[model samples]
Target: MKRSKTSKSWMNEHVSDIFVRQAQSDGYRSRAAYKLIEANEKFKLLEKGMVVVDLGAAPGSWCQVINNAIGSQGKIFALDLLEMHPIKNVDFIQGDFRDELVLHELENKLNDLKVDLVISDMAPNISGIKTKDQAGIIHLNELALDFAINWMKPNGNFLVKSFIGEQYESFIEAARVVFTRVTTFKPKSSRDRSAEIFIVGQKIKNIEQLNDFGLE
Candidate 1:
């Protein structure tokens, strides 16, 4: 099969990326593993026996990082639209996170367990249209934020991938309403040319007060 010029270029770039080579040498599932690791190092979000929810965790790289960090003491629940092979100490749910059935399944699996952290690496399928892609990415970030507010315990944390664009301000503002502190981070592993950045919202506050603070 013939690949598009863009696809071929992307493949070539992926092959040449230092992080890609590093991930392979380190036995991580994907290069994205380092992004989470970098974020965790800066934030100190992971702890023993803490419950974590990973949204859009297909390919399981982020889950792998979390699993290693939490070890046998913590639990990790992951959901995605695509299937992922099982990883030890990580519960995998293969389905669209936005679907009611999938959400219920995750909730059931959670079983009254409060999440200590929620991490989302979800990205929209790019159509080469910057505006549309940004909108989709922003929407996904909002959904992840909603999950964090509802499912996370007080003082919990949320780490989500977002795009840098005109829509970014509103997104950060919304995040600030629910979390005591919110910061934007661009991991070294993230491509410099890419507009993608991670938003880390820490010390989740009272959900009831979120609305008053301007968060939906």
Candidate 2:
């Protein structure tokens, strides 16, 4: 089958992308690793012996970044709906993150280990319909937030990708209420045309203060 113009253009751009070339030479799985690298540089979030949860971690680029930053002492729990090749120390879970059973299995794998950081690069599969895409991404962001609230260690941080849209303010407000500080970042690695931004919520408040945003 002939590739659509969009797909062909994406392929061309991917080939020409500096970050893509850098990722290839650096032995990372994808260019997405640079986003996490830039975010961590600014926030100083990853530590040598922390436990982390990576939602939508397919291709395992972010997991690679986490693995390098945290070293062998740290633990990574990575979840994705699609299959991912194993990363040396990452515990990969294949399932829909929203499903009750998947959540149970992930928690079981964690064995009640408190997560020191939760990062999500999840975005809905784009259908090119703006409203629907926005809604879907927001829902994923909420799920990421809920997971952080439930599983985070005291003073843990949550970093998630979010798009600028009608839901943006409400989402930031919601995060502010639960975290001691909430800030937004647009990594240089993210395309200039893309509206995607990272929302970093640091120093979480008590879980008792959380409003029902869907938690187990």
Candidate 3:
């Protein structure tokens, strides 16, 4: 198949990217690992003995980060629509995480254990339409947030990858309603031209506060 000029240009750029080179040298699956690593350093999001759920985990770079950071004491469940190669001490689930059947399977795997952290780097397939793409991205973030609300333990953290778009402010406000602290960050590892940002929501708020905020 002939590659389009745009794709060829992107390929050339991707091959020459510094983070891509670093990822190759560091044995990480993707450049995205550094984003998680940097966020953890600043936020102290991961801890020994913690239970984490990683959404959109393939090709498993973030799962690799979680695996190394958590050591033998922590548990990680990595979910994605595509199959991922196995990682030491990490559980992989292949399915659409938003589906009821998949969610049930995830819950069963956890065996009622509450999650200490919910990390999502999930993004919808880009369709090249601005509004449509934005909507897709926001919907994924909403699904991730909803999962965090239902499953995260108190004082747990929710770290999600998002973009500055139509739903950005409202999404952050929704996070503020459920979490005691919410902040947006962009890692230096991310491409300067990219709009991606990480929204960190710390310490789940009580139900009363959620209701007060009209989030319940």
Q: Highest lDDT, which number? A: 2
When summed lDDT is taken over every stretch of 10 residues in candidate 3, the lowest stretch is 207-216
**lDDT of predicted model 1:** 0.90
lDDT of candidates 1 onward, in order: 0.90, 0.91, 0.90
TM-score ranking, high to low? 3, 2, 1
Tens digits of per-residue lDDT, candidate 1, 1-216, equal: 899999999999999999999999999999999999999999998887889999999899998888888889999999999889899988889887767798889999999999999999999888989999999899889888887877889899999999988688999988888889999999999998988899999999886787676554
Q: Please provide TM-scores, in order, for all candidate models, with all chains considered together.
A: 0.92, 0.93, 0.93
- In model 1, state the lDDT of residue 143: 80
| Candidate 2 residue-wise lDDT, 88-175, digit = tens | 8899999998788998999999886999999999898889899899898898898888888888898999999999897988999988
206: Cα error in model 2, Å: 2.9
Question: Model 1 shows how many backbone clashes?
Answer: 0
Weakest 10 consecutive residues of candidate 1 by summed lDDT: 207-216
Deviation from native of the Cα of residue 60 in model 1, angstroms: 0.7
Clashing pairs in 2: none
- Between candidates 1 and 3, the one scoring higher on TM-score is 3
Error of 2 at 139 (Å): 0.8
Question: What CA RMSD would candidate 3 show?
Answer: 1.7
